[model samples]
Every structure is written in C-alpha cells, then in structure tokens.
Target: MPDEPAPITEHLGELRKRIFWILATLLVFSAIAFSFAEQIFLFLLEPVIAVMEDRGSKLQAISPTETFFTYLKAALLAGFMASLPVTFWHLWAFVSPGLYSQERRAVIPFVFASSLLFAGGAVFGYTQVFPLVFEFLSGFDTSGLIEQSWTMSLAFSTTARLFLAFGVAFELPVLIFFLAATGIVSARKLWSGTPYAVLGIFVTAAILTPPDFVSQVLLAIPMLVLYLLGVGVAWIFDPERRRERIQARDEESPGEPGSDSEDHSE
Candidate 1:
C-alpha cells in the first residue's frame, strides 16, 4: 500500500503541537530549577567561592533582594540549559522533512557533538576561566584605600554571560561542518583561512571576556583549536565527496583523441 501525503494544514497543526510541547517541557524544567534555586546558585558560584575562600575575601550582597533575584536568574539559566535538548530535538524534527537521508545522517553527529561541546565549554569556563577572572579582578584591590564588595546581581550576571559565551564559542566546529555540508564552503577553504579565523577568534574573545589579556587568551585559544578540529573533521567525514569531485573533474577533462570530453581546444 502507498503512503498518503499529509495536508499542509495538518503539517501546520503538528508543528504547532510540537512547539507547544517544547514550551511545556521548558516550563516544567524551569519550575523545577526554581524550586532548587539555592543549590543552582551555589553551583554557579562554586569557582568564585573557592577563589574567594583561598584569598580570604568575602562575596557580599549589597541589597537583600539581590540574593533572591540572583538565585532566580541562576534557576532560569539552569532551566534553559536543561531544556536545550528538548528544544533542539523539536527543531530537528520540524525541519527533518526538508532533508534527505544523507543530510539527516550528517546532521546526527553534528547535533550530538554540538551539545557535548557546549556543555564542555561551560564546564571549562566555570572551572578554569571563572576562577582566573575572579582572581585577577580581586587582585586589583588596595587593602586600606578601597573596599572590595561584589554585588550578587553583577557576579551572577557576569558568570551567566561568560558561561553562555563559552558554550556558543564551542559550537564553531558544528557551524563549520554545516557550512561545508551545505556547500557554502569547503574543508580546504576553511583550512586555508586559518589566519583570518585566528584573528576573528581573538576579536570575539576580547568582546566576550573581561577586559583582560589572560581571559581573552583563555577563550581564544580554545576557539582556535576547535576551528582547526572542525576542518579536520570535515575533511575526514567528506572524503568520499572529495573523491567524487576529483573523479568528475577527471571525467570532464579533455585528454586523449577518443575521450568522452568534447575538445574545444584553442
């Protein structure tokens, strides 16, 4: 028996339902995170806390409401991170109808890699970058002339921004892979553009990190390595495509007297 085609209206209805479900899943996670806001805040502030403890500095909240709102913000960020998989799956499913089997296969590795890379980047920022940044900022304080007090809102906001920035930066490889797969660019072109890519990564690092060379370098180095990794992965994964292109070029070449290529030699 032949399969029946879905109506446009039915497809639209299904899309709406999926969107609703994604939203519902996000909301559920958000509520759960909010319920555990204190723990989430502690988790987010772990690196800073450890650094502060080592230096005998206190992290203080200027206002009573600051702590409350900081926890709420932490919970929201946690919820967003937790719900990302559901959101991505819904998005993948929604657009899957437009892709062929090969395209779909290529997409699977990218999606999985992207999620893992993002999580790893976040962990890197939290464990390595955050402590270093906090230490650098804290070191600038004078004992008698100045007082060091970090606002809860400012601390949490900065942590969240850095975490998100690192996470997105780690997705560079996935972006490259998609560009290569879609023919917008090739692995060879990406490899050839290494200098420009390095410059761009440093620029992005300056923009995303605190106004310090150490933080900028920390972000830029990882991004540059990831870009190189992307080129290698694209080359290895698409070797068959490269071979086919080479074969096609050879077949189209005007070689011998009785070759398939029609000679318009001048």
Candidate 2:
C-alpha cells in the first residue's frame, strides 16, 4: 500500500525548515563574500575599467558612503551566486516528495545544470553584453563636451543588474525540462508557440537590459537561442513521448502463438 499523505502542518514545518536552510546558506556565503568584497567589487568593474581606460576616464565615489555601499552590494551579489547550489538543492528537496523515485535521482544533475547555466549566462553578460553596452554609451561622447565620470554606486548597480538578469534568463532549458518532465507542457507545444515566445523574449530583454537597442538585441539573441535549445531538450527528454514510443513498438510486435490459449486459461 502507498504511504499516507503528509499533514498540512507537517508540510508547513518542512517548508519552514527548507526556508531556514536556504537562508542560512545565503548568510554563510554572504559572510564569506564580505571578506573578499573589495576583490569582487574590483573584478566586477573590469569591463567598465576597460572602456574608461581608453577614454582616460575613471570611476568616482561621489559620496563618502558610496564606496562602502558598493562593496556591500557586490558582496550580496557574490553571496547569492555562491549559494545557488544550496538554494537549488533545498528547492528540489522541498518538492522531491511529490516526485517519482526515478525523478528524485535527478537532484544532482538538476543542481549542477542550473548552477552551470547561470554561471555561463553571467560570464556571457560580463564579457560580451556589458562591453557592447559600455561602448555604445561611450559613443555619446562624440561631442567631447560632457565629462565621462561614473559614480561607484551607479557602476555597481548597473553591472549587478545585468549579471543577475542574464543568469536568471539562461535557466530557460532547466525550466523547460521541468515543465516537460512534469507533463505540464510538451515539446511540440513549445515549438508551436515560437512566435509568441519570441515576442515575450524581446519584451523581457527590453525590461531587463538597459534602455538601448543594442543591449536589448544582444540579450534577446542569447535568450532566443536558449529557448530553442530548451525546445530540443524537452523533445529529447519528454517522458510521455518516450512512453508513447515504447507502447507503439509493443503494439507493432507479433504476439506469441499461444497467447490466446494463455488468456483463456487465465
């Protein structure tokens, strides 16, 4: 017999525990990040520094508190990135009770894939997208009348937002995999909705990226690619489709010669 369902109070208690674990993980990573906050802050400024170097410009801390706050913001961002694996694990653990035994075995793969994809997206933003954006903004200095000094707070905020946006966006394939695995959507259905997906991707890109056509296009292109990749992953791993294929194969095979006699005896 199957096990009884958990009580509502028990479920709530489990949820609270999972939430605490996630929070504790975040806090621990945040503390570690705070220790290296200056290094992380400088690393994040690489792209901006590259552009500014060419123009003989430098970033400034306009207020006395600006540098301190920038360091704190950078530490927070670093902590979140560092704690992603723990976060994903807690999330999966929270929902694993509802999954099949086979599905529960996917916990490690899911966590690893999520972390890798998020990191890839963040790196892509830092190396490819951020440079273009900075370069485009620098183009506005053609008149040579306005100075090009950036405040520490402004630089940190802008870079952190782009980093986070790209990282979240790149989890498209994982989201698709979960939706397909859970039977909430099919690969064919996702592919058929390409037009609408493209529209949504562009809109999301516009909202997440800086208000510039170049930045929007750059972000949208990768997102569109990732969406298509998601479609392929869903197609390859869809459990329903696999079951259908197996059933079709069984139906096509010849039955045993004495199958009728066996059925009659039974």
Candidate 3:
C-alpha cells in the first residue's frame, strides 16, 4: 500500500524546517565568504579590470558607503554560490517524499549535477560572456571626449546579475529531468514543441541578459542548446513515456495469455 498523504500542518512544518536550514546554511557560508570578500570581489572584477586596463579606465566610488556595500554584495553572492549544493539538497529532501523509491534514489546525482552545472554556467559567464560584454561596453568611448569611470556599485550589480542569470539558466536540463520523471511532461511533447521553446528561450534571454543584441544572442544560444539537451535527457529518463512505449509494443506483438490483465494490474 502507498503511504498516506501528509497533513497540511505537517507540510507547513516541513517547509518551515527546510527554510530554516537553508537560511542557516546561507548565513554560515556568507560569514565565511565575508572573511574572503576582498578576494571574491577581485575575482569577479577580473573581466572589468581587463577591459579597464586596455582603455586606461578606473572604477570609482561615488558615495562613501558604495565600496562597503559593493563588498557586502560580493560576499552575499559568494556565500550563495558556496551554499548552492546544500540548498539544492534541502530542496530535494523537501520534495523527495512525493517521489517513488527509484526516483528518491536520484537525490545524490541531482544535487551534484545541479551544483556542477550552476558553477560551470557562472564560470562561463565570467570568463567568456563578461569579457565580451566589457569589451563591447568599452568601445563606447571611441571619441575619448567623456570620462569612462564606472562606479563600484554599478560594476558589482551588473556582474552579479549576469552571474546569477547564467547559473540559473544552466539548470534547464535538471529541471526538465524532474518534470519528465514526475510525468508532468514528456520527451515527445517537448520535441514537438521545439519552435515554441525556441521562442520562449529568446524571450527569456532578452529578459535575463543586458539590453544588447550581442548579450541576448550569447545567452540565447546556450539556452537553446541546453533546451535540446534537456529534451534528450527527458527522452532517456522519462519512465512514464518508456512505459507507454512498452505498452504500445506489447499491444502490437503476439502476447502470452493474461498479458493484458497483468498490464492493467500494473
């Protein structure tokens, strides 16, 4: 027999517990990141620094608290990055009770893949996307008539947004895997909806990326690739679809007695 559904109060309590643990994890990691805030800040600033060096530009602090706040934001970003694995684990734990035994067995792989993909996305944004964006932005000073000093706050916010956008975007495959595994969507349906998915992806890219064609295209390309990859993942792991295919094949072949009854029982 299946387990009973959890009571509403129990569900709420579980949610609260998950939230508390996630918050605690965030705080602890944030504290650790704060200790290395300067290094994190510098690491994130590399692309900007490269562009600025080429153009002899410098970053400035417009307000007295700007530098402090920028460092604080950087620490928060770093903390979140460091705590991502724990966060994902908590998320999986929270939802695992609704999954089958076989599905629950996927927790470790899910957490590991989610973390790896997010970090890979962030690194790609920093190393490949940011440099191109910064280089493009630097070109606006071709006339050299205007001063090209960017404030620390602006730089931090811009880089942080892109880092976050890429990280979240990279989770597409994992999200699709879950949806497929849960029977919310199927690989065949996703494949048939390719055009619509491409459209949605471009729209999402436009929303997430900076307001420039180059940035939009760069983000969209990866997102499109990830979507296709997600469809492949869904095809491979979707149990419902696999069962349907098996049923269809069985119906087409000459079957032993009681096969239909066995299928109905299943």
Candidate 4:
C-alpha cells in the first residue's frame, strides 16, 4: 500500500488553523481596546497635554463627535500595536517548517528585535521629540494674537502620524539585517554610504517634521543613530561573508552535506 501522503498537506491545514487563531486573538484584543477606548485616548493625549500645560496653553475640540472619534481611533491603534506579537508569531510559525535549523534560529531573534526597536522609537517620540516640537511650535502663537484652539481630530492625526513614523524608522536595523543576510548589501557598502545616508536621514526628517528646526533635528538625530546601528547589525549578519567563512571551514575537511565528521585517530 502506498504510504499516506507526505506531511506537505498537513502544513496547509496547520497554516489555516494558525491564521484563524491569529484573527480570533486580534478580534478579542480589538474588542477590549474598543471598550476602554476613552482611556486609550487619554493615554495617547498625555504627551500633548503635558506639552500644552508646560506652555500654559489649552487644546480644544471643535466638533461634538471629535473626542469620540479620537478615542475610537486610539483604540484601533492600540489594538494593532498590542496584537503585533500574536500576528508575528503566527506568521513565524507558518513559515518555520520550510526553514533550515539555522534559519529557524534567526526568526525569533528577528521578531523580538523588531518589536523592541519599534517600542523604543515610540517612546522616544512621545517622551522626548514631542515635547521639544510642541515647545518650538507654541512659540509661533505670539503675544496678544488670536488664541489658537487645537482641534481634537487634528491633534489625534498628528500624534498618530508621528508615532507611526518613528516606530517604522526604528525598524531600520531589521531591514538592513535582512538585506545583508540575503546578500543584497554588504557591510563595506553600507559603511561607504555613511555620509550620503546621514544627509538623507536629515532630509527625510525635514520633509516629515513640522516646519521647525527643533522637530527636524529631533527626528534626524535619532534616525542617524538608528542607521548607524543598522550598519553594525548588518555587518554581524553579512551572509556573503558568513557563507565564505563556512565554505572555507568546509574545505578544511571533507564532510557529508549539512553534516560534520568526527575526527577519528588512534
């Protein structure tokens, strides 16, 4: 009798199950977030409130529904952020079996690093960058001028954009590490582009930030630091060099594919 078909079919079944599980988890978290949406909004607005308080200014909502929508938006963001680990793990599990042992070893570290870096970026934007930016921008109000009233929707949108941008920027090292691991970039090449890269970081900062030097510098400096750190990470994961080292070691002793031989001598 022909043996049962290989486990390839089982992989598809497993993938579908994992996908369902991930969706269910996200839905559950999203509901929780939606229920406490107001608290989430308040937490999100803390930096804005702190900055305004420091400047002796106030933020206002123009529309009756503005605060509610802002809370809803914050809930969605919170849901996605909180569920990221579950999403990543599902994806990792789906692709894991197809990978060699070494590839499998790399997956967890990559996921953890990406999540941590993103969190670091969000914290930096909230705790440091936002305050400086608001302080600089508040100066534009001028004395005896019409009092500025900040709309809730506008405030939420701006803060969300900043949070997302910084979080994405923090993934630079993961991007570089993957590219280097795939042999698409080399440590030497990345090192050589340092000057241009630094210029590009600042230029990007200028484009994305509000029209003020303080915000621009705050974004650019951290971006440059992240890029430099990415280069170091890419160097460590440089696949071409890693392959060469492995090959040289292999040539030193004949061995079966993917297996090492035990040195035997009397």
Expressed as tens digits, the lDDT of each residue in 145-242 for candidate 4 is: 66656676787787887787788778788878777866678988999999999998888877776667887788888888888888998878788778
Global lDDT of each candidate: 0.81, 0.91, 0.89, 0.78
Model 2, total clashes: 0
Cα error of candidate 2 at position 102, Å? 1.0
Q: Write candidate 1's Cα lDDT for 1-266 as tens digits.
A: 22256789988997998899888887788889999999999889887777677766767888878888888898889888887777767776775666656677645665677778889899998888888888787788666577666766887887898899899899888888767766678788888899999999999999987678877898999999999999987886565577888999999986776554454442
lDDT (Cα, 0-100) at 4 in candidate 2: 61
Worst 10 residues of 2 by lDDT: 1-10
Residue pairs of candidate 2 with colliding backbone atoms: none
What is the Cα-based lDDT of residue 121 in candidate 2?
A: 98
* Residue 103 shift from truth in candidate 4, angstroms: 1.5
Best candidate per TM-score, number?
2
- TM-score of candidate 4 relative to the true fold: 0.78
What ranges in model 1 sit over 4 Å off? 1-22, 106-108, 142-144, 239-266
CA error at residue 134 for candidate 4, angstroms: 1.2
Candidates in descending lDDT order: 2, 3, 1, 4
TM-score, per-candidate, Cα-based: 0.80, 0.92, 0.92, 0.78
- lDDT by residue for model 3 (62-131), tens: 9999888899899899989999999999999999888888888889999999999999999988888999
- Clashing residue pairs in candidate 4 are none
